[model samples]
Structures are given as structure tokens and as C-alpha cells.
Target: MTSAPPLAPSFDAARALRQARETFDIEAAAVAGLKNRLTDAFSRSVQLMLEVRGRVVVMGMGKSGHIGRKIAATLASTGTPAMFVHPGEASHGDLGMIQVNDVVVAISNSGESGEITVLLPVLKRQGVPLIAITGGLQSTLARHATEVLDGGVDKEACPLNLAPTASTTAQLALGDALAVALLDARGFKAEDFARSHPGGALGRKLLTHVSDVMRSGEDVPRVAPDTAFGDMMREMSAKGGITAVVDAHQQVLGVFTDGDLRRLIENGIDLRTKCAKDVMHLRPRSIRPDALAVDAAELMEEHRITCVLVVESDGSLVGMVHIGDLMRAKVI
Candidate 1:
């Protein structure tokens, strides 16, 4: 005799929306509850991570393993040396990856994942400091942990209360909290973050400097203060649509752009006698080559202009950056 087949799950739009809202509420409460549970253990955990000479080894099982991977990534990107080592794999030869100087962050909602529990004695023998993120205060993981972070949730968002929902959210929140505290303690800055994420958007904005994208050398349009209007126009048209007026020492005196020529023509001003110095706009907006490319974009946006000259501290013209250059670099 065969058992009856399970029925297909029925969908209810109104019930689905209600469940979504409840899930959010439960998850939010789970995170909020962590604030009151903060103890000196959090600081100790951060100090352990900060002082570790080797990488942070994060371990977990099942759903907790997924969260562990994310936590490891967050820690690594935030200036902490960290990587995830699956508990199941650790029971294999992968346990060799852990070093005595490394710190271990173990995650388990029940605090009794067998794979993680089995490795406790070995970790203890190796003298690796363990920080446990778990809900069971008196479970095996908590017992062996040098620091135990309470990730307890009153109830799961799942209707059956069997799935890891609110519990996992609480674990993730705790992981973020750890990373944030560790980063703060280490004095991690945006520049450090950009260095770790050189391929990301923030990296592009922070690591890319004006020198990286600015037109330099012969590509930069420039003219002497006494250069003839026709000669300056020729240089500007050949280089870019703008020309910088400089002294004998290459110290920027002013700038003349295509817009200036258009305005001069519109006003019917005599241009035949107008040398670079005669028609140039004095003290045009400029940026240092070491400045972030985003700053150059901001300067262009603020001045309602499409080009910005790059200069040294002493105001010597080094290069020029156009909005087009910034666009090509994706700095804008």
C-alpha cells in the first residue's frame, strides 16, 4: 500500500502580503532585540579579531554556513582579515587551513551543530580563540566559546517555526555588528575600503584620481598669456574645446573656452586684437591631480562648466579634465 500524494500548495495574494509584512516585523524585532543583549563580549570579540596575526576563520553548518560566508566577506572587505571554512570540510583536511594565530568565528542558531561541536575539542587543543554567534546560551558552542554573542530570536518568521528565518536575520545582523565594531576599532577608513573593493563603484569613486583620467602632456590645451587669439583658437580646437592661459613658468593665469568665443561673437566684441590674456576668464576653477575624480565631477557640476584644469599646489597647470573624460572613466 502506497501513501497518498501531498496536495499542491494554494496561493492567496492577501495572505501572501500579510505574511511578507509579518516577516519584516519579526526580522526587525530580531535585530532590535540584539541591542539590549550587547555585553563586554562584543568588545572582546572585536579585540580578538583586531589582534589576530592571521586571518579570521569563520565556520558553520547548513543555513548557518551561508551566513558565515557573508560574514567572512563583510569582515574581509571592512579591513579585517577573514575567510570562511565550512565545518563539514574542516572535519576533512581543510582543518589544516586554520592557524594558531587565527581567530575562529562559529555560527549556529541551536549552538549544537554536530560538525561544529565535533571540532570544538580540536580547536581547544590548538588554542584557537573561538567567538560563537548563537542563540543557545548554555549549549556546547557557548560552553567552549571564548566569547558568545546571543543571536536569539523569540520566534521564526516561518509559519511552521521550523525554518531558519528570523534566526538567520538575527545572525546576519550580529555579523554586521561585529564587522562594524571591528572596523571602528581598527580605524578603518573609506580609503581602506576602496583598496579592498577596487572593482566596485565606491572603489572607482575613491581610488580614481584626477591624474588618472585628465588629459596631460601634449594632449592638454594651453597657450601663453600673449598668444594670438587665432593661434589660441587653433590650439584649443585641436586639443579640446578649452585652452588654459599660462605665464612663462606655466602658472595658470586664466582659461578660454569655446563658450567664451561664442559669447564674444554674440556680443560682437572685437576679437582680432584679443590675445589669450585679453579674453581669458581669470582664476578658473581648478583641481589638484591627486584629488579624487569625483571631486572633479563635482567642480564641473558646481561651476556649470564641462572642463576643469588640474594643477599643482603652486598653481602650475599639469593637465585638464573634461566631463567626457570623467564619463569615459565612469567617475560621473
Candidate 2:
């Protein structure tokens, strides 16, 4: 028998790109479907959540279990304390973790899992509210649930239409929707998130204070505006900062620095005979003492300055901030 011709090597980059784009487009279309369908089911889900006296219990199997863990984590970090419980484990005696006041959030793409189906009755008997996140609106799990959240995708991104791709993406986006809605309803603030993420860079940025970093009192270099340029140099050098604030009536009139002295010399000004006001940088950039350290950093960058005078709201000089202070705080 004649052998079939060897299969040709299909070399089509455009075909691969088209397939990749199709997957993302399918997921996008599925998530977009959830935007206009805020039904009584969604309201009941939120209401049951609000009324519960205990934490939310998230459960799923397979790929949904992975998504459930992430959803639980996001909800926990955003003001709703929740934990993932594997339905398979629950049948193996983990269901005892479910309290009478807790709410059960069961996630299954098809709304039917042998493990999850086995535990539905026990949860119902315990009077735990069951919130189902599933792809099918008429599945047995949806019918058994106290509230059903539909995350149905028109089709799977898998070439065989078998793998959980677009459906799982839709489930995650809906899970995030629930978390963000609850977060805003609870008046969750940036500071609240910072408390939960204290080791993160954002926590450091939001919680940092001016008093924690500013050079206060005598450590902040200051001198009278009428002080001679020669005397100002001594003050600036003794303080070890780049500049000295020239104060008049307790408010900064300008600043004199090593740079200013160099400019003064190059400009033919007699250093010993000139006053600080005559050669100082007039009306220099300053920040309020109560401003966030990050805001101070921004002002420093915007003006291309290495240091700034910390002033009171009434314009009186209070302290100083430097690039070094921001770097030490690890906020730069």
C-alpha cells in the first residue's frame, strides 16, 4: 500500500495570533454579560452576607477551588473575612467548620459537583445561606442555593470547548465584583487596606507621617535674613544640610546654601559684606509640616530640589525635609 504523504509542517504565525486573540475576546464578552444583570439574586446574596454574624465559607472543586481560594483571599483583605473550604474535604468531616451564622459561597462552573452536591443538604439543614456561583442558571446546585450568581460564558476558550477558561475568568471577575461592592459598602478605606498589608510598600507610603521623618527644632538649619552671607555659610555648614532657611518674622524669606555662596562668588558679590537676603534663593519651595511624606517627595521632584523647608499652615518655618529623609524611609 502507498504510504500517506508525510504531514506538512504548518508554518502560520497569524493563525496562532488569531487563536490567542480569540481566547481573550471570549473572556471579555463573558464578563461584559454580567454588567447589566443585577437581579434580586445579587441583592439576596449581599443581604444574606450582611445579615450573617460569622465569616463567609467559600467552597469548590477542581479549577473552581483555585478560584475560590483567591476569591476568599480578596474578600478577606477587603473587609469581608472569608475562608476557602474544599467540598471534598467537607464530606470527609471538614463541614464541621461551618457555623450556624456563616454563609456558604459554593463555586462550580457547571453548578453541579459530586462533592459540592453532597454537602448542599447539610448546609441547608444548618440554616447556612448558600450563595452559588455557577455557569448554569437551571442546574441542581442553582436550584438548591438560597441565592445564585450566574457567571455563564457563551463558550469556552478551549479549542475543544471542554477546558474551564472563559467560564473561570468570568467567575473570578464576578468574585471581584462582590468583593469591591462589599468593600465600598463597608466604607473600607485605603488606611484599612494598609493595616492588612503593613509589610507592603503601599502601607509604608500611606501610614508614614511628617513627624516621623522631619528634622525638627535646632536640627533644622535656620538663620535671620539679615545675617551676613559669611555667617549663613557657617550655619549651613554646621547643620550639615544643603541649605539654611532665612527667616523673617518667623516665616521663611528665602534660603542660603553652599550653592548660593558659590553663585555669589561667581557673580562678584562680596561674601563678607553681603547679607543673606541679598544673595539667597528668594521664595523657595516649601511644604507644610502636616503633609504626607509622599506628597513632599513629589514636590521635591517637581521643583528639582534636594531639600524643602517644612512650614506651618500660617507660613511660619517649622522644619526641613531632604532627599535623604525620603530615601531612609524607603519611600523614594
Q: Could you tell me every candidate's TM-score relative to the true structure?
A: 0.93, 0.82
1-332 per-residue lDDT for model 1 (tens digits)? 99999996997899889999999999999999999998999999989999999999999898899999999999999999899999999999899999999999999999999999999999999999999999999999999999999999999999999999999999999999999998998899999999998888899999999999999999999999999999999999898899999998989999999999999999999999879999999989999999999999999888899999999999999999999999999887
Query: What local lDDT score does residue 40 receive in model 1, on the 0 to 100 scale?
Result: 93
The lDDT values for all models are 0.95, 0.84
RMSD of 1: 2.5
Highest TM-score against the true fold, candidate: 1
RMSD of each: 2.5, 4.9
lDDT of 2 by residue, 26-130 (tens): 888888987766577887787777667899999989999999999999999888989999999999889999999899999998887899998888888888889
Clashing pairs in 2: none
Report the lDDT of model 1 for residue 22.
97
Record all residue pairs in model 1 with backbone atoms less than 3 Å apart, i.e. clashing: none
Clashes of 2: 0
